[model samples]
Target: TICGLFGFELDNFERAEVQKATRRLLEHEKRFLERGLRNFLIYKDMFLKSVYRAGLPEILIYLPIIESGCSPRARSRAGAVGLWQLMPSTAYDYHLRIDYWVDERKDPVKSTEAALKYLKRLFGYYGNWELALAAYNAGPANINRAIAMGKTRDYWILRKRGVLSRETSWYIPRFYAIVRIAENPAEFDLNIENAGKKFTFQVLELEKSLSIRELCRRAGIPYSEIRFLNPELRRAITPPGRRYNLKIPAGSLAPFLSAYHGIKKEYIEDVAVYTVRSGDTIGEIAERFGTSPSLIKLINGLRGSLIYAGQELVIPVKEGGLINKVPIRNNFRNYSSLISSSIRYTIRRGDTLWDIAKRYRIEMEVLLALNGIGYNEVLMPGNEILIPVNPLLSP
Candidate 1:
């Protein structure tokens, strides 16, 4: 019996169905499924523990597989992010902050905690796996109204109302398929391994802000690995506004902590900011900020006022902060006149590196190198990463 965080029981046929659907989807995606199995296996333990505590159905485990294929940097078209595909509002309501420097909704551990907490509450209300699952897709209010209007508790009946998106309608079935396959993968062509292996990590309390590049330099870990481990850091640098509990590979923590103590907090870099140009409208400014005009207006004290030339407007950006002043090298010079800078995108529930690369029209390898990740690294939501200049593909 699956236990929800709030201590409820999930023993309904809904669990079985969701499992079956998830398995089918996994089979279908076998072509795209390659590598990262080790990380997925490690994450599975986290998933099971949370689900067991929440009294959620085991079938719900498959939700992440569909939502992000266990990728931490996964994002969705609807702006949902992370393994649980949480929207910014939902993540915020659950105490996941999305800011210029970090978005915790993409952090695998953080997102899983939020998602399990939400699932538990949904189960508390309905005591049915299918209904709770529906609520997970469409908010609880939507499911409650459907229950009241249809005069039935059947998920399929509500699914036929044509109100739910096609994805939502099929979502439940997919969940079931995955659960079914996970239960007995050997029966299928799937060969499961590393089911019980533990992922080793140690926590470091951060006081000063630092970039992943610097951390990588100190920890002797690949920059990409640090990015994968802390996707919630929207910038390559962590900001002073928030205290971060950085996780490092188990044995590396001692060395990292020792080196971190020697490094002064003030030595940490700040994220770079871009000033608005003359005749630049909010739309252009938004593009420059890599955010919407509304967000820009909200950030800067602008009442949609006309922007003037030489106005030094602070650009609201995410990811690494300003670069520390480096001694000018005689060979190096700034020649490009284009407005080029980096944007930090918080990994959300449904984001993938490939999707991110495609969205920015950047080569996959270049993006991976920029963020310090390998080809098969996980992109958890709530993690912050730097996006280098690619204005030609900017939207």
Candidate 2:
């Protein structure tokens, strides 16, 4: 009867197993499970509507309960992320942008749409709801292999044969239990509250890069509220070189637009650039700049932590109007004397005085003074410059 009501029928044995699991879940993890269920209730209307629009079953909304505990920021040990727990590769395959700046996986609307498309494709491949669900948990390749090895396409048969992981084995039953409980929470002594107001927002396309803090300050929006809406942004600031779709509270778009225009360009600071040194790493650079590795990766558009010597990276400094402060090693007298022993050096692509000084073990001040260059002077490739190399050091 429960299966028929849900538009999917399970045998009596399967029903008994599902009920047993549901009872166990309710007994031990009720409070913990209720928190996730409550979160789902907040967005239930949005989720169900989206799923129905995608021509998927409304019950699909319950998938996130098990996948992410209804948390948008959920990330798995296997690198799955967001409400639907999408793996990076899977997200990318589905055209969900997973850059350092905006991981669309964290966006509920975007991730849910992507998840639906993925689910539809899995259903098409398996041609069975249960098999599709299994494929979704363990991947189609794993399920295909299991089907081949077990000589059966039945999800339960494959599970019984131990061809599927224990987690995959229970995934469907857990999903079913959640669906049943959600259909009638009152039966389980659960009290679900209506999401007071539907989560609503307006997207403001940013013309230029700005920090979230500055955006909130200018628009008079709460920092926590703005951040909560755009959890995908890895850094405090929106990334440069593209129009970022910034989500703002509903009814605040007009104020935000007016204030954003009034804000001076200088008030929106540029990210500091740091050229990598021989012994530099993303972690070390982050430490030096008082930022995070994720922020560095985001600003620099790096997918990984591999950085080579002389690579320029954008440093994610939270504070504005801050200069890059490289430590001056030598005294003024020693620095002045050190400039006397100079060698003619040609600037390469992306070369800076900071990098040159670090490379030659000379003070940056001495390098600037020796070359008659200003601190803000742009260095061009093939430009000849004098480097004050130490007598004991080789260039």
Ten-residue stretch with the least lDDT total in model 2: 327-336
10 residues in a row with least lDDT, candidate 1: 330-339
Q: By how many angstroms RMSD does model 2 differ from the true structure?
A: 16.0
- Write one digit per residue (lDDT tens) for candidate 1, span 161-237: 65556776777776555545555566666645655645456788888665556666776777766666777775555
Per-residue alpha-carbon lDDT of candidate 2 for residues 190-264, written as tens digits (9 for 90 to 100):
756645645578998887776667668887888888877786776677865557888888899998898778764
lDDT of 2: 0.71
Clashes of 1: 67
lDDT of all the models against the reference? 0.61, 0.71
Please list the residue runs of candidate 2 whose C-alpha ends up more than 4 Å from where it truly belongs after superposition.
1-7, 10-14, 194-197, 265-313, 316-395
